[model samples]
Target chain A: MPEAVPDQFQGFAVDKKENWNRPKLTSYDRKPINAHDVVLKNETCGLCYSDIHTVQANWSPIARDNLVVGHEIVGKVIAVGDKVTEFKIGDRVGIGAASSSCRECNRCKSDNEQYCKTQAATYNSKDVRSDGYVTQGGYSSHSIADELFCFKIPDDLPSKYASPLMCAGITVFSPLIRNLGGADAKGKNVGIIGIGGLGHLALQFANAMGANVVAFSRSSSKKQQALELGAHEFIATGEDKDWAEKYDDYFDLILNCASGVDGLNLEEYLSVLKVDKKFVSVGLPPVEEKFEVSPFTFLKQGASFGSSLLGSKAEVQQMLDIAAKHNVKPMIEEIPISEENCAKALDRCEAGDVRYRFVFTDFDKAFTA
Target chain B: MPEAVPDQFQGFAVDKKENWNRPKLTSYDRKPINAHDVVLKNETCGLCYSDIHTVQANWSPIARDNLVVGHEIVGKVIAVGDKVTEFKIGDRVGIGAASSSCRECNRCKSDNEQYCKTQAATYNSKDVRSDGYVTQGGYSSHSIADELFCFKIPDDLPSKYASPLMCAGITVFSPLIRNLGGADAKGKNVGIIGIGGLGHLALQFANAMGANVVAFSRSSSKKQQALELGAHEFIATGEDKDWAEKYDDYFDLILNCASGVDGLNLEEYLSVLKVDKKFVSVGLPPVEEKFEVSPFTFLKQGASFGSSLLGSKAEVQQMLDIAAKHNVKPMIEEIPISEENCAKALDRCEAGDVRYRFVFTDFDKAFTA
Candidate 1:
């Protein structure tokens, strides 16, 4: 490891101005590790729709200024604070969407810090520190986070495959494990309603958990991909005539990963849910698309529909353990970190060029001096 | 019991021309009970919104001319079949919304008879016998039901109070009990939307089950009645400004009892449900109403929205046991059973004039020779 900070520590820094549409590699300072923090030399940082949303300022209430936009962080812990006990220097660790939370709250105490009242996102979120540094993310050579928010990656899990799992995997995995009576039970019919990032990972996890995995996608192109990803069945909603009838009261649980509410009629989904079944959502999109479901759907079937945020550190660890045990690997494309290449990768991700996920390899980069 | 059939057993038959209006009840010979059948002599039969819908003579693809329309049945078993073990002569048993189901199916085996493939409702339903008899309900003097559908009324529970438990009571009870993690766990804040029959009973059951019960009604007039029925709080949607915001995320479960697709906004209700909480509906009005809710309401908070049907025989027994133990009783009005008053009861029920439930007595007047 280099003793001195590089003249140009490789990082993709985005200027949120309209004219500045691309990310650039630059020299980034690493704060001396705090007593309760660890500095990760980013081996892989997964690119996400959220990152594109943050970079392009597409989503409402988006960051208005400079922001580094990667949260699916995975790498070795190069340095740790004196107070940190769970992690040490050279230990492999990962961070998901959250960077910090009020540890005193009930949610934090229960290892559900993602839902904490004073939660901080990995990027574009105001830091809770007295020094008031805004939280930056893992589109860089290195990133630092509190020990509580860091997860030790399993030795067998590849850093490339594990990167997207930090965000996309945990986003879907948390709900499946939590809602289906936790990580123990099996033989449940778990439906994944999308064949994208969250949906693919959800299919893998549900299949790994001994559930009958059903993948639902709008396009038939994903049918082969879904089946190859351990989906017991693939449903192309756009192609089927009266598909809801065939699958009515079919799933024990349904995880909807589609960002649009119009993709699936909630009433039809609710009908597919048997008595006491749950339909959970993890995607955050616009609200104007109307979702019309009747009270009878809820009343007659005893079904439920809800959503899940990114998982906590504990859930992420559990997900990693499950991934390792099942030898589950997300199909990913790793890209070299640089200004021009990073912009291209982001553009490709925006155009849905990658099979599943894109990870930025910032450690060995041209900008590192 | 009467030694012989009365000579006037054929009196006041269903008009063949207006047979679509109501089923023929005069042919009820009060036949010898089958092994799995329970012969209940009607004492008080409650009027349900569904009962009126069945005979409205409008909507029909499945509608038959000779349809019987009553499900909230409270009466004494005059006799039991030889193979029956659960009940005998003189045992008070009540029949609810459903009467028979294919016990061999998964839903039936799991005790979720309402979802059974070959399920038969108490009224306007076809019996599963080889020579299928059009199943008649409690609007007549006598009701014969499968033993599995018959519930033993608690010794201390009033006939009128226990009557609605078979239908309206169980409708809300199923969602409340299941969503709250049953009666023995940590009690939660429960909201009963709509202060009609089902909502009133839901308030009672929710309160009895140790939950903090809140009643939601369109008019302020139901405030006192709601509180009297064990609601700790009342929210008149028409009267309360920003009520959804004032109590946002306050409830662990919201049981929606309104039967229409109109005037119900699920997004506003979802705001009041806590993380992992449920917004359930049980009222099945004819048309399918669309709920306008953004996926974010569920995804971010991990909250759920869904429906529940009437519970199983086991669940019904559990509810009855809890009701008996808690002395939970619904407010009800009793009326005399006569041909002249049937239309009045149906009209009054439709107009929402009764306190909560209306029970019919004077069976002898309707069936006398």
Candidate 2:
């Protein structure tokens, strides 16, 4: 039997074929939910660097002429397909960066679906459903995702605050939890670099995990705000020339949210890690630049470097549970979900003008109304 | 009161004051034993790459003018200081790369004395003991070392066969025991790159740990020998261009015994590791070249890279126990302890001529005779 067509909805999508190739709010036909899929009435969506990368075709080739870009999605479940058993109508849900993956692969079956080669992202990614139309993201009034990637949001969490957690929260949190043993690493010293969106949330998570948080930024400008956001100590790498050397073997785990393209001397940061410590980077630098790792340094100190993808669905649920239990809140500024506002938000985010994160809301007028 | 002088012994010494600046079989006086020190009549010593590195000044600056280069030492204790408790006269013992450390530091107390900044190597290194002279190694007939670094040799293990285990064995075994969790990693797939000294012992240890071992070398030339050494599978990376791609996400642990200086495409090897798996290397590459690690690659796959120094004193003892228990033997060739033979061994090792490792014996004539 053919699936029923859903009501048309509006989305802020990048029109690659347009005169200036800019995003414009337009009406589009919504695909009905597939057998294991759930359609979400999008309530709030957080803006990330990835959104800008997709909208502007920054990292890779963009295959779609019109693509909606947002992954940190939060909404109410309006419809569930026949095979979906996890969620019902009106269940608060979210969809992070990963939208679909081949569940049959070994990685998928072994709790590492994020690394599956056939893994599909939430936006401008291959559908792999039918190997046809692209998978649109959560910049619209509605979203359709597989139940495997759809997470049930906690009832106590607000949609606006919880939106960023779906993406930024899990990226850094996963490495900390995976490499350092656990998130409840009491008395562990954690170093978070780049005091921006991801860095801010990382500090909060690390602090809530009972770790001593050290925030590394360009300067001490964010000292007060960083301490306010749960960082026990703040280091201005640029301001203090010997900052990295001063804290020799200081950190147990250093979550690098910054990229090396910004002239950040990674070796100095590496020097700060204690013996047998872990340094996991969640940020991607420009492709042209290759970071040189000295075997002498790493081998002598017995330190390590790892990177984390968005995270797994199981970790997503755990992140929400921990955030609720620990009273961890993601700092964000809510903007009205309109074409004009989203366009301005994209420009502001590119300029690093936002305090930390920008969450878009007011989906009622774009959807059912 | 000054300590009574012990009977002096001769050794192969490198006097920096010489015009040619090469190690020669010259008569040099050995220092007296101190409280908590054990003096051994050298039996056998293993020739390692470190000997060449120290003697030729290929690595770091040579601080000691009169340095004797040998760390993998196995000998019978001829005398013990009043305070020495672990060994008695005629007790057999071995000493690897490290000779002494500040045992009171947090790292030393926590069983990680190998990384203590004040760590003293057996040769060309600072002596933590109040004794004035630098710590000499196994090239001599009589040697002085603190009881802390002396590991009792197992009765069943042969002195010639076990000499290399003090250094080369512990170098590889430490990472396997530490990073991949415990050494009892049964049924796990492990990749051992380079089929020589370190690689051979690593394969034995991994195989004894019940892991399925894969040997990766330049070509299939070592296939039969690798299989004989405990490899379940062998890969010729140079001959097969797509070997790395064919086994994507195959290994759970890859002990990179081969160095990056050998033009090994490490990124390709990285593709063979499963998600969240660890790739550890014990070899030091040429310091001039930096291996490029793309954040995108590491983050996407969620794998990690680590390097390990040799095992600690306690770990060294543990490695010997495990090796003896599992019958993990290091392949070695014995050469008489003559300056002429020792020099040839160094050159031959550099040319990859030895089967695996070279042990220098006949130390009785070289020193006490």
Candidate 3:
């Protein structure tokens, strides 16, 4: 071996020093690639609410010390093991929320790797095959992952825009494409509720698939942005009192991306569903948030309520290809990857200040500094 | 004009006696048929729970005194106007729960006629075309309906069995056939909950369509009957403590037909759904019965929950043709269309005492008495 690898690199970590907790840059140890794995020099990563949840210890379990958190990773395959075949050195690549899965399980075999019982998260999770080394995330400079779980990012899509697609884009894209019959066949009207990270991408994908895209947001601030993002109509639920009433039983499908509201009049959203319409929920709100609807909501109207996880690798690739074909680039805000910007971006997202999505750039310092 | 075509016919009406309510034979006026309508001589009509609700004035908002409350009407076209082309004077036919719709609406144009805002029920509902009379059902000797709403029942199927196909059979058959990609598709694991009227026919239809049919009921008493009706396995929920647990997340499709529980553990049923599985509710138990489920129940597994009404006129005919081709027949308990048997059958249906469905067979008395 060469000289010993350093025990620290510049990365973001929550400030435990103050009474009002916040995250700041710090040095952290990085793991080396195993014989069957590859190391990605992450160029950019998206700042999802999921990352905020991790640092803030909100809906998810409390983050342990040095639990570097980011999943929507876009990078270059700087190193690969001897066993890798599909990926090699200098290949543009991406990694989503899922880091590893037992390929032998049924869910994994069927391309639903996200649902595999033994699947590992890219952050705050234990690697499945590695010998007790916990999985770090894309927030760090170098992320060592099994070759099977890493994805090849397309050349046409930029790293910053590509980062959010790995998580927010794919989360919405999977259900919209899968539920409504994918890239080829366009079905009826598709409603994208909440003009947040996922919703913005969903409008693009739905419009890309030749569907009538309708955007629903609480504020009028995003109306023009949403329409410019290929939405056919923008309904501000906050500004418009009779939005739900006027559009009762109107949409064929509704993608709900908003999080954390108790007794959300899910029934009201359901009211705009025509017979045999499907209401899909991909957002995970509070664990204690309950959804209640009258059986007549289902029985009288013949509507469906469902949920889905992130897209499979194949599906993600398909979505990327479709995005390329339709020129469906997600609207994004890129921030320099630094300790100060990390907390600021999280605060922006938490306060509903993001126009759509925020992606962090310049991961060179995260690895080598 | 042939003595102005006598409006009233000898019919039965509920009367208040000294101590009890009684059905008395009396003259009842028939609703006039519009230009777009056809009049049918009821040959056989199937008794249903809604009819009982109407007769007892129990579910009052849905009930009306003058409404002849039987929607499962298998009849012969006795009269057709110049506009009626789908049916002729001698054709055998059936009319389901829906009688009229605003044909100009998007729903009606798309063949989703039942969900039209201006939809009229066969009984206890206002007419869309005429607005001159309340639509009466098949309990009377003669019934009038817009020809567009009537379905052509196959000649080979017995009228008694074909009558319930209008309501009970189509309610279950529509979802099964639609979701399974029809009866000819392969190896779909289908579960029919509640082996009463709807479940029995669903079991037959699902099995006949080359699917593995599992019958779910509360008691073992229906096991032999269910198996004889072509169920592959009988799951008596009460007898088998591990029924839901053992078969958790196993079924591809579950048709829930049982009603009246305040809050059924729908999430438990959802847990029994395979990936991308659908749990469709066909029976409308009661309006007050709420459906409770956690968003996590839907989100984590990506399962679907919904309901479907009776099949369309075209779908109904297709189901009838499929039933005839497969030699599938409903196990119905035939009751005469007299005051005594009608009341008794209704009571038995309400008490969960009927084997499957009760078809009212004696229509000659309504024709002449």
Best by DockQ: 2
Per-model DockQ? 0.53, 0.65, 0.54
- The whole-model lDDT of each prediction reads 0.75, 0.80, 0.76
lDDT per residue, candidate 2, B1-369, as tens digits?
322335555677776523113557655566656777888777999988777766666566556655678888888887788989999887889888887777777777888888877788887776886566667778877677878788899888878887999889999998888866787878688999998888999989888888899999998988999999989999998898888778887888889886454586767777788888777888766566567777666765787777889988788888888888888888888899887887778779878899899999888667543
- Against the hidden reference, what TM-scores do the models get? 0.86, 0.93, 0.89
* Candidate 1 all-Cα RMSD: 4.3
Name the regions of candidate 2 deviating beyond 4 angstroms.
A1-10, A15-21, A26-32, A56-58, A240-249, A259-262, A365-369, B1-9, B14-22, B28-34, B130-133
Residues B1-369 of candidate 1 have per-residue lDDT tens digits of 633323222222233334433334455443335568877777778888887666763323334434456788888877666767898788889999887776676788788878775777776567764245666778776777888899998888878777888898888887787778877534588888888888888888898888888899887988998898889898888888789878854788888887664777666777677667777777766653466676665654577777777888998998888888877777778887665566667768878788788887777767753
| Total clashing pairs for each candidate | 16, 0, 4
Q: What lDDT does candidate 3 reach at residue A155?
A: 82
Residues B189-277 of candidate 3 have per-residue lDDT tens digits of: 88888887888888889988889889988889889989999899988877787777787546889998885545456776777777777
The CA lDDT at A360 in model 2 is 91
The true-versus-predicted C-alpha distance at residue B299 of model 3, in Å, is 2.6
